[model samples]
Target chain A: MANISQPSQGAWTRMLPNSAAAFHRISALLTLAILVIAFSFASPAFLSVNNTLTILLQTSVIGLLGIGMTMVIITGGIDLSVGSVLALSGTVTGMMVKAGVPVVPAMMLGVCMGAACGLFNGFVVTKMKITPFVATLGMMLIARGAALQLTGAAPISQLGEAFGVLGNGALFRVVEMGDNGFPRVIFPGIPYPAILLVVVAIVASYMLRRRAIGRHIYATGSNEEAARLSGVLVDRTKLIAYTLSGALAGVAGNVLMSRLITAQPSEGVMYELDAIAAAVIGGASLMGGVGGISGTMIGAFIIGVLRNGLNMGGVSSFIQQIVIGFVVIGAVYIDQLRNRR
Target chain B: MSQTLQAAARFDAETTPLVEMRGIEKHFGGVVAVDGVSLDLRPGEVVGVLGHNGAGKSCLMRILSGAMAPSRGEIRIAGDVVEMGSPQDARAHGVETIYQTLALADHLDAPSNLFLGRELKTRFGNLDDKRMLAEARKVLATLNPNFTNLKDPVSSLSGGQRQVIAIARAIYFDVKILIMDEPTAALGPSETAMVADLIRKLRAQGIGIFLVSHDMHDVFDLCDRVVVMNKGKLVGAHDIDEVHKDDILSLIIKGELPTDWRPRNLGELEAAR
Candidate 1:
């Protein structure tokens, strides 16, 4: 036991390059770079500016949800109802807009509704003493049912052009030379949804790395008993994490609705899985207390690139799903190996 | 014979105790873990609690530390009765506990662990990592001068280093009374000596210490008074200079005072010295 308690000299040398967390993040970035290079070589369209924008736009919704998922996972908890909550939030906004409500108010109400759902989950998990997995699982069913009930199981379409700008509009358009030396319209208009993703990622990363609440979150996840003994309000921290996740899900729902110009009660079905996968691939551990936003963003990009490249290369969506499933498992396996060392 | 000695250790107006736990009782289901055990600790004093595995020493201390609530007890800190509903409550009243497990977040670095729940923040309300790191370095330097790797997570640290960090945390927040449960249980000889010196330093600063341990030598070396418990009941309380090691051993094992002994007064103790 004494020998085990003392770290070996060799282990110190191995850890010198970086801490274990840094190592995981570096490996994640390396994997993403390799994928980008490989995909660019495999498909001519993969490296195009339009295709790059498409990937970022595609990743925006899931990326926002992944940021929230990263926070939840760091506290050693899971929010399985994010997709359902997103669907319900978007459906509510669509229904309100159809009933002649202004777009901005409708979107704000939708976000609030999403936060309310999260607060409910927090109450169930913290106040009622239910496990996070079970509480969020129940919320998943409830939110999905609520979405269907609100929309009468139909899709709400024909939202105004103003609402669509939140998802489809781009800014800072510029022209540049293409790979073939032809003058191409390189309008690098940044999508609003992608902008939202970047802003959320920056805020979340700053909170996790430079804020007291963020430190408390990590401490709470790492060891609840210890945090409690150290005078931390563990319940409040968890409640905030769940609430943030719910609100982000709402934002994702709005982005999806605007991008498609329609809101369906089933629009975000199975999206929670993708969000969780992105966070995990970015190095967020299911066991909690070990993840960050940057890693999660990279993880989100990795998934986005894989899906876009595979589709362009004529790979079936079924095969893409299999590959994604294996990637999630592989990432967690590597995490376990790192922990064991 | 030790009963009179126990009675003499009771609080008086002239020397108010730093902490006084009166009639602490804890029950789990039908089993009584602690049965009306009362203890007192004075400033700049070390009170060693000695007991068998199931003798209720931990339960009594846990109640004082606010980790567990006593079924019935009144805790007075500095002559004022206070409620200990949670560890936060205890800390608010200048009470801190160093648990046997150390209660450290293994994923966090030394500075983070030192300010785990109550972190110092900058003017902008962000965590002031630079300030915390500097403070942690000062604290760690005083405890263990050889410890310099403040960036590694505690999981990567040795048992001794971890113990030092735990101790530093307890003392950093202006602790008036510290409850240490088996602090040196996992340390080597040099590490143990280091802790012993730290304890003496704290004692010099007028902080009260409640040390729960099974090591007889530690009790003899560091304690001013020794309290023995067995089967959920306190058997004896003796001034270190007034009782023999065999007397404490007999009380711990049999839950009874020594047969051929008489409680001696302070003057008698001085004469014996």
Candidate 2:
């Protein structure tokens, strides 16, 4: 009824903050683009190809986690243990590789461990009848403590170069040979981690768009009781969401570990906040039933670019935090105003 | 308990009923929500349930729709007893309900809401959104020619449009018994009339309907038979023409027929009809 009158007449209405969900993502994308342009203007180095790739490389971890968080939030649920679960999965994978397990299998096992943690989160949230916030908050502490206890509070080091390929390797590598000097590299096509992010984002976006499970998630989040009466498997939909969130966190953990070649129990301490912030900025409502991978990917870029830009601008890390915090708040405020309209 | 009402029965009750609720009893903790009540709905019949607030009309309907499980009861669809553990089971048995709240996802488009649990999928097991859109347009057009904007979320629709979506959702699938709870409660007069027309159309299509309503006039205009409930007990069911509105009112308020009420003879009932 609200937009029943000549729906296609106003292009301006489509651009407003109170536009459709797709346009909500566009707003986030536009914001990301603006941030990139502004940062390039603020610092010339920010426009360099090397610096651009670095921003995307850093965004891979949070962007992957954002894919899962978007799904969980869309089910009107939250997972606070992704950061800690990432540490746990990374450490477990580290232990496995150190014990002579194949790097790929260890990595797969790591993702499984993350999925297990997520399953626990889902179980507690659904079966134990605990609120998702409290349930996942409890898992957060438990997973972090478990990670520390597993290694006697020591970091797993020297994970070997073979395991590092997933997060540190590059694809389509280009090398130039010249007579002036020895072989010189001309370009690195794409970081393996960034490629991984792209692939995962594509699959996730497809699932949310073209899957029954995806429809159930939106329905459950919009109104759980209505969904139940409509015969939606609400509980199962939520379980799948939290479990997938965990698996993606596991992937991020492996990427982090591969980049560092060390699994630190203290690593990913506040990464959950980053993932949540990215989702919110990407137009995902905290109340759920409204978000997508595209917006979330842009949200991750916004955060990464904002940090790189601020650091380039010679702002302190503390002030960068303050600025990023306000941006998140501003994004939500605009969303609120849109909903009010 | 009346010969005239039996003579005026619109449906052939002797045949196997489409739905048979046997000794349906529901208890919420220490409270008795629905007492031992049994009812039957045959194919193509519209059975209207009349009751006051908390008089157990909703509870009975909820149990029938599989939204709530009766503490003690047996339900049969087409003469086969069923254990309706959830709404999905009820739907599997060709039972669909349009709840009082409409129960539509506010954020999903019409097609998405139309196939909330049971979705159309391609051979690859992915959602067949294109086919769903086409099917939704066809189904909604049959109900309301004015309905457009299948892409917009249900939240943006008008009251009548929302009602149409709810009805379309219920009737789209292989629904045999359509349960409508206060279908016209939120509609304007014209919308209410539209719903009435829809009910009639569905009845003509041989879809047995369970119409739960507070509007007596609507019930009389649409329902073939009416059952009055008071304090979780069924007072009686009467053919629409056999009993006056005041007699049904007495059953609702007092849980009994009026002292001076008498069943009209078959000849008089036939003459009146």
Candidate 3:
């Protein structure tokens, strides 16, 4: 009996290759390749190392938030509160640093503040059983109000130089700065913070796809009742996914403040839309049980290029919004098509 | 003749009952789904539960597996009364249920699905991919050695492969009692045979199984004892050797054994139908 069953099981394993993972990867790669080709044709500067690095630098913050968005979406949830959390975290981080608090501790406090806001959203969505869309929407309003009230609706500037350096500074050796004499391409000019984006993507993808906790996220999204029946802590996984998303958004907010040298109460308004768009474009199903960090990273870059390319081509900001709107719709349509099977 | 000898070989000589449920009752919004349903699952015993739709077979299993809270009941594992307020509670008490849908995440691979909801993480909070993949191979080898494509996502697997993963997951968790709901409902002949072999192997390992199946041939082929329920009430339990297929069907549909029931060969039963 063992011998008979062994051959049959081998036949079972030989018959199929588990196409969904491959399909997911292929879709992401296809999107990346298309984006690269389109941008390359649209502008000569798009392929240049300096401009490419600029896109990477610009996408870092969105990429950070996109990782969290991917996890949340994978668990069949959303975090509309991210943008508000970002602004609030930025306000607190900026205030603390400006008040002579140490930079590291202040950054920690800012992230914690974002996590706390996420906890509220998670508790409401999970414990209270509110729909994710509505729960996070309420959180979005509360976070926005808190930011406005704390800063009196004003942009706080003159943040410490240390914090500013984290956003804009890159470790590089300047060979020369002359326009004609050996135009010095700054060696290792990629922003250190930009590397942080790549690292975040790799780590987040590993956790979501490879780990046991990652499997739970997928199971939870696939069927909440089944997952709970399989001994999964369904409510806890959701809470963690939402909290991580908010915390990442907060980190993105700090990165923005570091770059701009100010904590604007309205800095990240509507950024949640961009983050969600990135996750969707990267193959995350709005219904859940799909998505990864690498796809989201590419998605963030695609958005950055769309915005930057339009700007460089002299398109008005209003037109940029129209283009982004069309792109988001097109991406979601393609996602629906891919999901039809 | 050889198959009957092998079938008898499937049951361990020193079998012991692993899980028992008594007086289990569950209700949903003024409707009594399960009431006064009791079952005993012994090691190396495949207990076939037959019932019509809405006859509370699922509700009874759900209460036993802790998927739903029972308004009143006692579940015991190894002679100790257990309260399964949630599915996790049942799991901790060594109970696992595999639903008809398989409940696998289509986007994830077999190893990932096998370890869903209880992943092994490294001390640094990273996924231990190598360890997980290795353990997946080891577990599938022991439970269903024919399963080999550990890296493939579940959606791409055949019907049999998916079922194998679901069963492997239950076995991997060291579940002493396995409850399967309509496991072979949609499989082809070859796939169904594969599942039958898996069930036999699980029984050989001293695991008790409560199989909820509509297939009478499956019950005769795999089960040691048959329990029948009709309209949320238990009819009776009979050892397969003492009763025949018609006797069990009569119990399932009519809630009692037929007065003139007699055992018949599989070919004769099919011919009669």
Candidate 4:
């Protein structure tokens, strides 16, 4: 019998092919850097503390949505109903508040409603054996119709000051001197939405990197038949993934409602596209089993930076939409190139 | 060593078989895939199952491994009958199957694949990655001492390496009966030899193995006894020393017993079936 060598032990980084993942992250960083440099030259305010904070705040809602999208995509599934769910949940919260319900309980119910909708999507996909695209597409229409019907196709305004504070309130204040030696208004209070985004991102990163359920998600996405044969409970993993996505969408909706101080039934229209774009840009594979939360967070920031930069550089909104579309295509193309290697 | 003498030996044998499948039958809608087949696997024995493409060898083995339920049969492990509702049920009974496709997640590393569904957990219910890796390394060392790329995904490894991982997964869980389907079908000569050596080691440890293969030489070299099937029916079972290459080949192709063959208790066995 051959003597067994001392088992090699190290961090997971030592186990993984560092170069490939590094290359993807480096390319994303380079793109963000180039954009930052070019925008700093175009708009003097681009690097200012307030503007940077503004970019982060802008990314928070979509970033939250992207976190959920990343998990769904990693499991080889897609959700087209998140945007509609967001609208519906936000409308429900608004209607509850108008009916004298406490803001906290109303928000909790909205989040639960989102989870219920997600569970419904999961049921249709797993139990009814429907394709995720078709099932979620049906849910998208159903949720949107519900949102409109709840509010009579009108926006809900006059939300109380206490509720609005959750979205617009700052965690702390920052004071800085301006060019003229005068006290400039530079308040870098942490946005509540940004704080929630960070918390969700951290939890998602840990779950994907260090948990058994996370490993099962990757395995199921890689090969469903193999996973089932291995006793991986493929259907349960998918259900949890979709349900988590719905809850996050509800959270994003609450943030949006709070920020606007009103709940618009049409508030989250086409937001799913942006969320998907962020996940894809973060190096998530549509085919599944290949992505990370950090990459997705970076992807969300890139979008936020690009929009903010273009808006400050006096670019037209129409042209900005065209540019964003091309960037999504470009990001997916780069992802494909990486995968081929 | 004639068929009649082998039947007499079976009647006198007193040791209980590790697994017994009596009158096993499987039907897929209008097609009868496996019909009234009985097989007994003894401990520490390698039994090679040989058949043509549609002879139902794989289908029958699938039933044994709990991937598919038998239409009509009782499966007894060491004389206790058990229901095999799923692969998990079979594993609980210490039966493991290494499928033709290997049934491994290509994107996961060896250790992750080794504990795919049955992971080692800490007190807090978190995965114990360190312990799993150490155990994976230790188990793999027995199969392939030179296998050091435990961290790379199975997709990056060679075909033989992937096979090693799949086999390791089955053995790691303390399997009593292992069903390997075409294990060496895609392997090179050296890899095939490696698998043969592993099988020898397993037999020494008293594990019963069911080798399903199309390769006649492999069956002859590795199996102590050979069972042949044709048209979803057992043609004959023979001791390796009692049957020649031509005898097994003719039985497989023509689906007929040899002209001079006679069973000691053929009528009794037929009545039992």
Share of true Cα-Cα contacts across chains kept by each model? 0.85, 0.84, 0.60, 0.76
Give per-residue CA lDDT, model 2, range B187-273, as digits (tens): 889778888998888899888999999899999899988888899988788777667788888988988878887654457766768
- DockQ of candidate 2 against the true complex: 0.79
| Fnat of candidate 3 | 0.60
Q: Can you give the lDDT of residue B46 in candidate 2?
A: 92
Q: How many angstroms is the interface RMSD of candidate 4?
A: 1.3
Best by TM-score: 2
Chain B TM (all candidates): 0.93, 0.93, 0.84, 0.90
- Binned by DockQ into CAPRI classes (incorrect, acceptable, medium, high), candidate 2 is medium
Candidate 3: pairs in clash = A9-B146, A10-B146, A18-B153, A212-B119
Q: Highest DockQ: give the candidate number.
A: 2
Best by lDDT: 1
Please write out the lDDT profile of model 1 over residues B1-273, one tens digit for every residue. 435435434335478889888888899999999988788888988989998988999888888888898899899999999999999889998998999999999999999999988899999999999999999999999988999999999989999999999999999997999999999998999989988998899999999999998888998899988898899988888777677778888889998767886554557756768
Model 1, runs deviating above 4 Å: A1-16, A173-188, B1-13, B262-273
Per-candidate DockQ values are 0.76, 0.79, 0.38, 0.58
> Which stretch of 10 consecutive residues in model 4 chain B shows the poorest summed lDDT?
B3-12
Docking quality tier of model 3: acceptable
| Candidate 4, B98-131: lDDT as tens digits | 9899998987889999999998988888889999
TM-score of 4: 0.90
- When 1 and 3 are scored with DockQ, the better candidate is 1
Going through the candidates in the order shown, the clash numbers are: 0, 2, 4, 0
Off by over 4 Å in 3: A1-50, A98-100, A173-188, B1-16, B118-149, B172-175, B197-201, B241-247, B256-273
